[model samples]
Target: MLSDQIKTKCTLPHSLYRAQQIKDFEGEAAALAGITLYSLMERAGQACYDVFNTHFPDARQVLILSGKGNNGGDGYIFAALAKNAGLSVQLCQMGVPDDLSGDALLACSAWQAKQGVVEGIEQADFEKADIIVDALLGTGLSGALRPEYQRLIYKITASGKPVLSVDLPSGLNADTGAVSDVAVKADATITFVGLKQGLFTGRAIDHCGQIYFSGLGITKQFDSLCSSSVTRISYQDLSDRLTPRSRTSHKGFFGKTLILGGNLGMPGAVRLAGEAALRTGSGLVKVLTRQENQLAVIAGRPELMVADFDLNKIDDSAIRDWATNLVIGPGLGKDNWAKMLLDFVLASDLPTVVDADGLNLLVDKPAWKDTWILTPHPGEAAHLLGCSISKVEDNRFSAVRNLQHSFGGVVILKGAGTLICDGKQTYLANVGNPGMASGGMGDVLSGIIGGLLAQDLNLQQAATLAVCIHGQAADLAAQQDERGLLASDLFPYIRKLVNP
Candidate 1:
């Protein structure tokens, strides 16, 4: 399993940086540590070698595909180390040996000094190798791959061998995580220097299977040189926020959460959200839906208080006075009734969590409020941003930032690597799995955030903690099988995680 191959000894840093930041400040960081850039490269290569030995201990034959850059230099250094260690190692240099310069040329010379032969791509024996090391292109790639690189990448991918990528897989945008044409999909990736922000989101998640980080002994210096572009978080990091509740607390101490949605024929959406809120520790949970849905919404869940919502009557002030927190738009169809309820919820200063049709409604009305949190998947985010879904996925960090700027409050852009932005800082939650793609997941997430907000957590804290809890619940529920997992499977795990 992919999880079994992960390196648990190395702790990952919470701060993430752009590629340019690493390039610009890496030299100064090294200098501050009294080390040269080439020394950093050597440490990077050694880190990769250590990961390979630890993970692929049984493998004897290795193939290293190297380009004419620092990334390739790291590969050359690793090749020399492997050859000296009595492994059958073949180094395939992508570009001409004469084209190499600076530290790359020196690395190539070191490999040759160790009697390691540099072969061309044509001579690489993919079938004979137990593993392939991808050191081509690295994080410098911006546009589509060159024809030669593309052909090599296709050949390597088709080789059906376990692959380890150095720094990052080739053809992946270090800033956006988007692959223009093609990218190397590695079984494991060992990154150096600062952790690249792009490796955790969008298409990069599929390409970068298991990630290992190495700061090369200069991380503290490097991190001090510049501010990080993003923050990476997970359930383990945020679970402490769910501290022990007051021993003498009553039902009203936790605060009440009022959920508005479940239009005609859509009772299931509101039911799931209300239950998730209850599981997340909301003191009092209420669902205000169409009169016809009141029974269905509260059928199996007796804890939720169900009430009939009539658009014609529209007692907005009375409803606002009842709950401490509001959740709008689960199974809320884009109808006049849904619109009126959304407007009613938006009119108040109550902390609100908006998802599904509430986000779609905002695309037209465009209300910006500091007291609400907007959670949108890629499709809904596209609509809110007035762009294509592809555009939003192309650069999720940018999309989430734009969403926060335009809509105000905190914004959660949900996907493989869910991102939360609070206008000032951006956070990436690396907790969820593919099984979470099923229906009603967003509704559950919205409810979780609303429950946290109701419990007196601020917008950023509530959004970040809720996202971690929601995704971690899905991860636990999918441990047996991810293929047929349901959104409701997370309820038990959610209750357990919140207590931690």
Candidate 2:
């Protein structure tokens, strides 16, 4: 078994926290460390300025959109530094600068003292600016945008200016990844203190572009003091866990994977899953699809052992006996044929990756087992939870944890930030792209988990590693262009990551 070889614990580089959690962490830590708000504000601005200079060093003119609160405070600090550095800075105060207090007022005064006049929007020249800094709102944003902020945000967006947002893109919910009526679409975002939970998932990904982190000299303290809601998974963390196979290793050392799905008209689904299973290093892969689909599936990927389930000539006992692990789903529709095949697989004691229609069927039966991994997209999760898709999406972290509890196994909630939860721990995958939105993607994911399971990876290891592998492959494949990416395009990359 490869259980000893696989790493179940994730040492996340940056754990994700909610807006309030981060605030509390910063406040308590700053108090203990004797770090003043004024100095921290300076550090935030300094760190952001460094990253900005490295990225847009050639630019001479900058636009800083300042709002209320400490977010606006950071912008003022940045503008002061920029002006001092000989960059022409255009600072627009969305709110009156006189209203700013404490560190914010101090920052504004420093900028003014530097002869950097904070301009009104009417006086600001958008076309003259080389880069725009979004500081209209921060992690405190919720609900719809205020009318005045909306107009200003739209103006910046329409300018097609490369924007570097402060902390977060304004109007984005730092806790839920939900976007209000409007949010800043920045070219890059420099988040300070802690990595907000929202930045990695949902609509936040669309707004917070090319995310950069600046702990502002408080990263270690923040980590030690706060409990992160989710742990991010990366290939770098998992690479050393698997060493190169022994030269004398035999095929029998790896286990057999059985893939059952692809109802009559959907052979391609099963074929894609089966081929992916083979590519991911499963010792053997057999597809038990519909009778008519078997020949085409075999023709396309002959490495797979295709046994037509509907064909009475194939013995059920033999098919079940051949599998060391089972993958049930893909195009396994809700028809009688699919139900029959799924029931058989469900009855077996084999470890399984259940996805697509399998998850749909699971909604009705509502069973649980520690050995099964349930991969459900938002829609399927909604069905299982007996709620709206919006409800499932409104809180994906909660939904996945609930699924793990209800399913009594590993639950892989598939979406933007794919979440995997064994009863004991929850993991988030950061490797996928939007291009993975197309059809047959989940089928491939099911195959990967099942393939890893067949290799004797423990339930959590198999689910977590397979999720990362599936996402990493999709990301790699989408490099050419995510728009036209296909599920099969991930095959080569999937093979590469599994081996690495």
Candidate 3:
């Protein structure tokens, strides 16, 4: 059974580190806290047991998989504790017990002294266990998993039983969040010391069901040893940026946003973007689209000013002059008309947001502009970088940085864990859910960023805050159900998020 805490969202720390960083400095941190390595291992084991007891107390049978490293040692200590608590515990060993050394050997001996039984992988009973504990590997693991380990991981996943992983799930890359081949699909993971950057992004979201963090009483000391590789931001961290508007302020005080898109057959994308812009507190929003899309763009949202864009009219000076910030390429098709409009938008000095077809169009004519923000999903990002989608998703941190370095602006790599990089620093927004797979979601995000940009927020601030707001809105809208969620469903929640 899943715990109530598992269903509820967990608050995460802002700073995130790579596995190597934590491993390199953990000993120093322990010394600073006046604790030995074995003591730290004991704390890690105790923390894992506490989480298991709190989250899965109803379970009477516990199966623990232990390896030969420190992670396995944590499991041994947990097994001893569970046995002492009068719970039925089965400790399965993946490697020879004599191979263990250091704190791990000590832990194994302690468990044996407690009259614990260790079984081989072949003797383990998956059906009899209420919950499985994964302690097969630690942060030091990289590259492909051993064939035996892979077999065990596959078997564990197939068991359909709840799993509690100590540190990160086995076979998961702690630095990049990339799985080489197979990884344990843990129901809940208790990460120790510092939070691993890999646990928040990429394939980690699918493999790690729920994440729980334990500093193990050395968080401050550990954090003081090294700087974080990335920073995590959410709605609560950025909501203060949207302060209450001055009572005397007029419509023009918030600035105007000009959105360009909505090709002949697709008007919904542009409409969603325009409405999202307005809902996000843009003082005014104007849409310049095809003549056929004019009515569709303004049908229900009469507040939006829609105009017919004359493709024959080469001069767009007047339209360009109207917007304080620009959002281009929601439903834009990659025809000559799109190219012309894109070129026109690029020629201007306006701070702009480029998304959807705009990103697709950029593949042909790549130009670096510091004033624009480029938002791209994996496919579009792979196109922009001339690489496979797998390559981009494999190491999203590297891809986002490369995109920002090449594009010379803020780059938002949209996915399960959205990454925003501005060349200087990178931020990860751990909000949003599977429901965001619906169409027009990207358009909504682009418009939200444009709206905030028009309201005088800098490029980084606008991108970060808009992303969190957009994701938080989606989460709220998906509260009742994530399936069948539409982009338009986020409007009311978006309004509330921005006001916060």
Candidate 4:
């Protein structure tokens, strides 16, 4: 009921611009907004100042690590504002102050006018500051950090003080979310002009702890000029679609999710998937497994229809008619029995969400189908695309897009920030945590997608909504105990989110 009171704004429709795109519109956006470049810089600095004060109310000395770029200009402006606010401020320059120019030059002058002295990194003290702001690099950063910058950043990170970064974290590739050598780990980041697509995916998650965004008064201009290639999903975007069902609604109103897995020794895998399907609002869930593991899969879950009887005798068409959608993978092995089951499913028109070992089999003889969702981790995706895991890791955006085009279905590249692509549109889920690193997570994700598919959601909606729900459920479970989090722990949260 508390969720009902929370206002839902224009949430998930917000576009995420690439680093280049954000830079492309900065000057024009400022001009169109009836503001100057320095004025926007001042506003960016002011926004950061207000947020910094709120977050670090007891902060004594605000230490800002400034570089020679426009990002440093923001730092200088922030330092000036901090001084005016009667807060202690310390400004450290990465290079000689003589090198600063343009808006940055004006910002530095404004800071000096406030009697704030700038010191070089060699003379600055790290221990005296409560919160450190990293303004060393912005979107222009491409290659790895220089040796000097790495040492200082390492020192700042190892200091354990809460760090705030301006724009993108220093040394992080703002476009691809790739990090070379080292990047600053900030407790919170204040971004100006636009939200870069890189900050929400890949290795960027580790560096960007909490993000604080400000359009710097160019909201109208920025929104009009940019259209994101990808979108970010949150609960607000989908809450209306997943509202409580009518009082008269029955279980049969939802679709049946038929799960085919649990091949010989791996009985627990299929059980996890089946239970997740039920938890996520599937009307009925049936598991087709080997006779040896049928009892083990249904030991504690009596709701599931676990069947392996007469599978050798019955035809493939009989199984297809029993369910609305299919989740084929979680323990689907490469053995003959597994292959036979795969071929049988292939003969049907059932919409399917594939994962785990089933993904392995599909890679060998790839085919196209619009009614399928492929969930592949970096390793599995590498095998399917015949490329190295590092290549997939290097540029996840391109990899996911390639996978969708090659596989002809909605593809979910699972990782830190899961990427969901359907060849035309792409979406990103930023709700998961590192605790979801445990096993059975992917299996659970496949089941959730299958459950949504059973509810008659289209390929894109099922993939997008399911991925966000799965990740957010993990986050909720992880809050209690992230380190010891289990895939099954998400059951309660999944049930709650689906009902919200």
Give every collision pair in model 2.
none
For residue 73, model 1's alpha carbon misses the true position, in angstroms, by 0.5
Clashes in predicted model 1: 0
| Worst-scoring 10-residue span by lDDT in model 4 | 1-10
Model 2 compared with the native: what TM-score? 0.91
Instruction: Kindly report which residue stretches of model 3 are placed more than 4 angstroms away from their true locations once superposed.
Output: 1-9
Count of residue pairs whose backbone atoms collide, per candidate: 0, 0, 0, 0
Badly placed stretches (over 4 Å) of model 2 are: 1-12, 121-123, 310-318
- Model 4 lDDT tens row, 114-200: 678999998767888888988889786767778999999899988889988888789888777888788888877777677788888
* Candidate 3 whole-model C-alpha lDDT, 0 to 1: 0.90
Report, for every candidate in turn, its global Cα lDDT versus the true structure: 0.90, 0.83, 0.90, 0.84
Which digits, one per residue and each the tens of the lDDT, describe model 2 over residues 1-500? Answer: 11121111242254788899988879777766678878889988887787688667887999888887899999998988888888888999875887788888899998888687988766768999999998878886767788887888888889998999999998888877776677889888888888788887777778887777777666667778998758788767665555688899887877899998998699999999998888888889999888788889999998989877754533468777878999999889998777787778768889988898988888778888878999999999999998998888877888888888888889998888888888776788877887988898988988888888877788888888888888888888988999978999999998888777
Q: Pick the candidate with the highest TM-score.
A: 1
What TM value does model 3 have? 0.97
Tell me the tens digit of each residue's lDDT in model 3 across 1-500. 32322212456678888888988999999999999999989888888888897778788899999988999999999998899989999999997789789999999999888777888877789999999999989685878999999999999999999999999999999988899989999988988888888998999998887788777778889888889758999889899999898889998999999999898898899899999999999999999889898888889688999987787774767887788999999989999889988998889889999999999999999999999999999999999999999999999999999999998889999998899999988899998999999999999999899899989999999999999999999999999799999999999999999887
Q: Which ten residues in a row have the lowest lDDT in candidate 2?
A: 1-10
